[model samples]
Target chain A: MRRSALTSTLTFYLPLWAFLVLLLFPFYWMLVTAVRPNKELYNLSLNQLWTSHPTLQHFQKLLFATHFAPWLQNTMLIALGATVLALSCAVFAAYAVQRLRFRGSGVIGVAIFLSYLVPPVILFIPLARIINELGLWDRPAALILTYPTFLIPFATWLLMGYFKSIPVELEDCARIDGATRVQVLRHILLPLALPGILSALIFSFTLSWNEYLYALVFLSSTGSKTIPVGLATELITGDVFQWGPLMAGALLGSVPVALIYSFFVEHYVAGLTGALKE
Target chain B: MPSVQVTTAARVVRPAGLVGRVLENHHALGVMMVTPALLILAIFLAYPFGLGVWLSFTNATIGQAGRFVGLGNFRYLLGDSVFRVVVLNTTLYAAAAVVCKLVLGFLLALLVNREFRGKRIVRAIMLLPWIVPTSLSALVFYWIYDPTFSIITWALRRIGLLHGFINYLGDPNLARASLIAANIWRGIPFFAIGLLAGLQTVSPTLYEAAAIDGAGPWQKFWFVTWPVLLPLTVVVTVFSTIMTVGDFQLIWIITHGGPANATHLFGTLAYQRAIQGGFIGEGAAISAFVLPVLVGAVMVSFHYLRRE
Candidate 1:
């Protein structure tokens, strides 16, 4: 019995640490590469794991030489804009689908899920054409307009799962207390569904911030680029790969969404599992 | 917040005016409530989806208008060696990555499901890769795979495991392997966190009952845990398959479907043909070909939705 317990504990702890180390190694590499000075970065003799003296030169170059600021601003604007739009649409759509029980509500629910199924790879071609026709090509507004297509479906579905869990009976007493449908929704349901709303917000925000394909297709100008497209396409030039500024850009770009995620991770996980559960 | 005149809103519910008549029917209000979402879906999503299918039937190019030539683009794709390689590569990429994620994720979930201090923090760390933008993270992967400065090569050489550079993304086989490794890294969190949630739902009493039946830990897992986790496993499978199959940015950044197109996925190949190569029709056809599989996933998810 002692031997069995010992072996099991070893098996569990050993692999768990391995998983953590392997998973975190890349981000560690990103930070190390980002801040490592040029002299040490090229020195094959120096210890590769840690740099003796780190420099902010890469971030300096990234901020001044490149369109990094514009890209960051663009990403933030698009993500927030898309999140708000998707949430409003999702809030009403989820309420209607989960609560209204009107004719064809079931059909609409199915259609929304089907829309969520459509991937950017499939839509980008036609969307590019549409963007051109609208003369929104090479504009950040193009991304703002298109991102909600994917976001709203996901947010709506997630919110639907959330609203479904809040018992219909919770609103029964509130409605009898002279609370209107809108009142009951605002007072009784919305508060209960706030976690769902926040989760949807986080999901949509991260998704839009992380979006690559639509932003890549719609916005091409350096001044208008989002972080993902800018870092992926423009950061590298010729065979002289700029590893320093590149990693700096990557590390910086990831910080906003990561910060938001750390704050609401509990609700985020519930919303995520709830999303897949449906 | 919007105007909150529920007192006046009640009058509208009873049809005191023309607008009241519209508000009186809950069905009308439901449609009204969903209009913004419906409109967005109709114009941007549903129309574009249909347009993509139509474009696939035509010989569309970047600078020129195309006429409908039904099945012509697909006919070309059927014989195209590059497209065939793309099909093979995509299937291999998704399959390899999905299998690695499933196995590793199941193990990780099992290990993490145990009561441990700072468990929340550990799970948060696991979610890091998924949280980071794929393009940015994939750039980090690109550097890790860089020929001269590759860190993996450095570490392996340090351990006396390798004498020379590993050529992580420089050769076809190695490049495909490298891309799959990155995909697995990003995909693990989705499966781990997802299945861990499933693991928590299984009652302790069930395990206790299995224990009392003289079932060992292995037997307990096989009999009690497996059956309970099966439905969740199915859901996770469908979700992962669809996302992995259609993934583009990860491939584009890491390998760009390079090393003689050994790492080309359907999504990346479609982008190359349509956008980069300017053969929009063929690209649409390449992309549309994968629709049936995605539709299958959607049907499965929809079945779940309906059941819910």
Candidate 2:
């Protein structure tokens, strides 16, 4: 049945359009400010949203003048390092919990989930001291090591659901066919659980990619700073906010994760809904 | 009699030595599998949590250790008006942010639950705010709130709506409100996504059944939809509160507790005191205060999470 025009507009179209505008405006403004010529950006007399003289100078400056490239590298290395570490641990732990079904496994699973509830804000203060003690202070390793404190619990939780979805009968058949336990998991379970693994990787990567608090607390030196910390710190020199390149960095910083996300959008959303769906 | 004899024979044999059995046991394998995750969580998460508690009671500095001051940090925080303001701002920020996010999120969730054209694309687009890094989006907000060059201020001035540029971030109350608006903007999508998942599980059949009963739209929603959304809403709100209370990014980028410390949340305050201010003990104490609230919230929400 078709919805009437008046009811449709009032109920769906109006709110939908309004929500769209609210959400998209900031990103649109980010782009406008990024490309707008400095004169136009600063001058109030010029059109507020429209930029007649847009330039690539900010992007140029961001690449050549700043340590943005290293910041990107630093962010990439840190995110990847953390994602890999977390995913491996999660895979094994999830496999054990779901497949092995050993005594106390249920308790450990709940314990790990409980750890996920612990926020980074509380731990960062003490973690800073630990990083200092381990001599990982001011390095990417500090972030890599610390990110798992959140990522593993999350990834493990998601993977536990994934592993459980696979039938135990398949593993039983594999074993009956003389496949070793390791071989069965490798040939059957891992392939079957590929989607889950992809979701976990995407999530772990994004978690570390978008992380700010730990990066801010641990990495102080400019050269070692990740994108979030770098953008906030290095861009604003004293009181003058560098609008153009700051937006440039902001836009560019989001690209890697956004790219990864759109590529695996289906899996990401599915895994999320699946995990939270009760 | 034969079954009892078989059981007795199996019990007597026991499959061999205790050492060999333990080696091949499922529990041992389970422990081995969970070792890596357990190790990381223990070293990084568990250790630091306990350490934070210990550090809070000491008079520790950045590099120097001090003897136990025993409630000195808490007593000092009680006396410091800045800390008092921090607590007030944190509570206000969280409560306001939570209410806004839930309301807007609920509206958006209901909206998106209805079938429409290009709904998939619309839903994906709705997620953008939550997807991008807050540091980046908060910068976008920072630029918008700039005292002289604010686009919002300029637009109002141009429309003859105001005599001068509005100081969105410069005013204390305005700064706090602006930060909350920015926060709500980011948070709404997460609430929407999670609640939408909840909405999907209600099954159209439930709605159809209500419609057949001649229930009005409002009645249908209140009777059917609201009850189904309750547990999920609780789960999401609890999760959101934990994250929001612990939040540091949006505040740090937008205001940094600026305009006379109007917008400092607990996380930002803790970072300021411990990391930036180098008062490790005090910062630790500030951060620790939220623990009881977080644990309480988590315990309450645990039922909702484990409901299935």
Candidate 3:
């Protein structure tokens, strides 16, 4: 038994630890670098692993000096706007397609799925032109509107799976008991599908928060840029790299989505696998 | 006779007004419900796709419109050496990164599936790389790969494993490898967690049956785990392929297709040409090349989904 335990530890624990380190080292490095003093950051003699004197100067500078605060506000605004819009649309559409049994629902379902396959890479150029034509250039509303192009399909598909799992008998019983179709949806389907809807909300918010190319292409001004675009484009000036402030920005930028994911991880995993399982 | 009379009476007492009648009609209600989503998609997705294809056939610049040039953009791209290099780099990048992620991610799934202390926390931590914004994590990689004062270089030197600083992003070949490594790092959590979900669905009795039949570990996996994992693998693979192949953010942040544009994917190339260089037609054409591949992936996934 002891021998077997030793073998298992060697086989499992060691490799797992190595993988964890490799996967997480960057975040650790980001944290360390974010806190390290500029004096020690440039001083090659100091150990890179730990800091003798850790500081919050970088975070203070990021919040006070740069456009980081505005960028955060912009990112939050866009992500929330996009998530709300996408979830509302997706809920109605998924309900219609999954439960309504209307004509051509299958075709619509397939089309929505196909739309998810259309990556932003293919559409960003023309989208740039579209945004320009709509007079939304350098505006957060551009991302708010266009982000749903991707988000709706995903949210709709995931919610469809959730709606499918809920028993149709519940809706049928509600319909028979003097409930109108809209009333049935509001009272029965929506309540039971609340968990699914919450997951979709979280997923959409995180995705919108992480979105880059669209923000980069659509918003050009410093004040209008999102977190990803602001940090990447505005942080560095010419040849100078501000490692401390940049890492601080990265760490701060990741915190919101990371926090949300930690709370709803099970739902997040279920939503991910649920969509594919369908 | 009474039941038939009652049904006839109920039919006559139908929903009160036009609004109620419309809501009662499945076709009308469904159309109404779907209109908002379809409107957004039509205006944003479907229209832009067609516009993109049309723009690819013209010589349109950022400010000035151009007459249709038929196949001029495609013809020019076919002749351009940089475009050719981009095509190769994107293909190599996607193919290599997806394969590596599959292998390593599966290994990770297997490891994480075993019962362990702190398994929940470990699983949650594993997904951090994926949950973090790509651009942010890519910045961390950019710093890690810095020519001067790279922690990687410091650590390696301290271990006596190296004598000289490695220019990870300066050399063309090394830069490509660096970008792929970063992509795989960001991608593995997705596959590992996905496959782990699939792993949990397998029945323990199947493994017991295999063990009772004298099957070894490899044999049991081949006979039991492989079949169960195959469908999820195909789905996750196609999904990852679509995202990875059309990737822009990582490349944009880490290299910006730099060191003489050695790392330009279709997305980055399109941005460079159309958005930055003002050659909208050429950029549209560059991005349009990815459509056929996307269609092919969608078709494959659909076929698999339909089969099940």
Predicted model with the maximum TM-score = 3
Against the unseen true structure, what C-alpha lDDT does each candidate score? Answer: 0.88, 0.89, 0.93
- Better model by DockQ: candidate 1 vs candidate 2: 1
Docking quality (DockQ) for each candidate:
0.66, 0.58, 0.75
- Model 3 spans with C-alpha error above 4 angstroms: B1-15
Model 2 C-alpha lDDT per residue in residues B1-308, reported as the tens digit of each score: 45543343322223356654654467886787799999999999999999999999999999977669999999999999988998888889899999999999989998998889988888888888998999999999998898888878888889989777778888989999999999999999999999999898897899899999999989998999999989989989998999988889999999888877777888888898899899999999999988987888878788776774
List of chain B TM-scores, one per candidate = 0.91, 0.91, 0.94
lDDT tens readout by residue for model 3, B64-145: 7776999999999999988999999988999999999999899999999999999988888998999999999999999999
At residue B243, give the lDDT of candidate 1: 89
State the local distance difference test value for candidate 2: 0.89
* Chain A TM-scores, candidates in order: 0.96, 0.97, 0.98
How far off is residue A193 in model 1, in Å? 1.0
- Interface RMSD for candidate 1 relative to the native interface: 1.8
* Model 1 misplaced stretches (Cα beyond 4 Å): A1-5, B1-15, B302-308
Sequence-dependent TM-score of model 1: 0.95
Candidate 3 is graded, for docking, as: medium
Worst 10 residues of 3 chain A by lDDT: A171-180
Best by lDDT: 3
